[model samples]
Target: MKEIVIIGAGYGGLRTVELLSGNKSFDITLIDKNPYHYMQTEAYGYIAGRFDMSDIAIDLQGLIHGLGPNVTFIRDEAVQIDETAKVIILKEQRLSFDIAVIAVGAKTNFFSFIEGAREHTNGVKNMQRVFEFRQAFEHRLYAKLQNSQNSLNRAGDLHIAIAGAGLSGVEIAAEMAFTLQRYHKIHSEKSQRLEFSLIDAADTILPGMDPYIIKKTEERLHELGIKIYTKAFIEKIQERSITFKDGTILPFDFIIYTAGVKGADLIHTLDTPKNRQDQIIPDETLRLQGSKDIFCIGDCTEIKDAKKVLLPPTAQVAEKSAAYVARSITRLSEEKSLEPFHANVDGVFVALGGKYALGILFKKIRVKGYFAYLLKKLISRSYRFGLEIKVNAGYKKRHVGSHDTLCR
Candidate 1:
């Protein structure tokens, strides 16, 4: 069997594994730093205590255990890849592969160059960091409620300042506000705790999204009790406050930095063509332009084609790219010509607090409320069902994803 090693169990990496799970001719090993797959897009809900860990994480071992004898799962971090020798070196051992796919996604840009931001704010990149913020926020809120030390009208109430009102920041703020309101309801008479604020340097939130959608989202967020501050840039992150570029100081108990992103520094560790933003340059085939047998997918790659503009680092693009690559790989193995990847910019979906959501559907129509939530749940269930069947019966097993049935 041919050996194929795939790095990073993110949207793209895991999708590739699901696509090629049953291939008997290839021994597949998927490597990830974490043991379980995280639903990062929905991670804000987890931070807000709206969803539990089980709700956001899938059993990676269970998915592979169901695969039985075919695929192997190695829970390890990949440190380096030697393309010439087709070898991957982890912390302990180096493994060789016939074909390798590098889809390790981008990290929180940190923009550590900016003074004082690193030590003060929590980033939304990995699961551990997000969980840490959750713990911090909860701890402060609980302490405030228990305090005989502070007066009821004192200035020590729980204040959460989020420094980026982009998609993640705004959504997280809305979720946190709603969760805080729920907590406040139970302890209403004694203490008034929990204030949420969203700060963005942009003129408005969701800069890349439709203006009308942005307006609607902004209004809905306000209705949910989240304060939004636009056209404000952070000059420095202080111990208990955020100093704006305009010299205004806002104090808070917790700060979440979801501001900006750049390609991972690891991509620059090698000699590769990079765009102005430093994202790896990839050809239409999704292969690194100047590197042989090296493919780049997801947010780490710079997409320069006119047909498909550089997409936001979202899961949708990663999932689509992974499928395209898996099919292309199979085609190449059979001595067939490969197809170029042309991504269709589908509509964006933003989940509001509770069952409410707003986004363009099919890039033509607008959808919100219960119908959108139902669609989101249906998508998740369909994905889970398809992956489950793929593992149970291998690639030879025929499966259909139909709404009436579970696996459509």
Candidate 2:
């Protein structure tokens, strides 16, 4: 049996396992730092207390039980790789593989140019961060209400700053705004208004989204009284406030930084060509250049187009790469040629809040309102449910997803 090692239980790695598990010729070993598979796309709802923590995560160990004995699931951090010997180093042991896939996902990036941001600001990349953010947000509101500060008394004092106007940042801002509205409605006397500020260095928000959608989204956010600051460069973030490039300081009760993300640290150590962001550059076949046996997928890999521009690092692209790479491996096992992976931007769904969403379908069709929100929920659920089946059956008939990505 060919020993196949996958270093990530992310959308790419887990999907690859689900696809290749039934191939008796390939013995699969999956490794990840976390034992549970979490749906990051819809996690803001959980952060805002609209959904349960249990709603977004599926126990990976439980899922692996369904993949049968051919597959082994190890919950451990991958430290480094020795490409000369094709071995993956864990905390204590080294695992050799005939074929390996690197899909270790991304983490919060405060954009290195800015100082003191990562150490001070909040980020919601995973469950741990989400829970922390929820606690901080709640604590701020609790303090304000306990002090009996009415909406008139607390204006900018209850300020919340979100750095980056991308999907996650904007979505969380809307969720918090809506949640605050619900809270104020219940206790009219303790109506402490929150001031939400969305700061992005970009001249415009939602870089690749439709103009109409952007306008509608801004209008929706305005209904919640959110302040948008475009073309605003962040210079530094202190514990109590954020400083801009022009030395403008905005005091915030708490801040969430959702600006950028790159590959996990392990990917940077590989002796492969990498982009400026330290993302591994893969060839058209998703194989790491100079190492045919080792493939890459998800946010960690850089699969650029003919213009040398890389695809946006998103779950949908990862899904496409995962399926294609799995098929490539299957063909390789049978000594067949591999196909080039050409992933098109299908569309994306952005939840403005828990109940409202914006979807750009097929890169042309624009969708919004409640139906878009329903579609986002369905997409999140389908992936989780499909995983449960894959965990049990070792392999399930393929499930297709619309080109739905939250972040561009």
- For lDDT, the strongest prediction is 2
lDDT of 1 by residue, 205-319 (tens): 8877788679988888888878889898778888899888888989987888888876665676656678766677787788877554567777777653345566777788888
Question: What C-alpha lDDT, on a 0 to 100 scale, does residue 44 get in candidate 2?
Answer: 69
Worst 10 residues of 1 by lDDT: 399-408
Q: Pull out the clashing pairs in model 1.
A: 22-395, 400-408, 401-407, 401-408, 402-408
After superposing candidate 2 on the true structure, give the runs of residues whose Cα lies further than 4 Å from its correct spot: 149-156, 188-191, 305-309, 390-408
- Estimate candidate 1's RMSD in Å: 5.5
TM-scores, all models, native as reference? 0.90, 0.91
Residues forming the 10-long window of minimal summed lDDT in candidate 2: 399-408
Name the lDDT value of residue 270 in candidate 1: 55
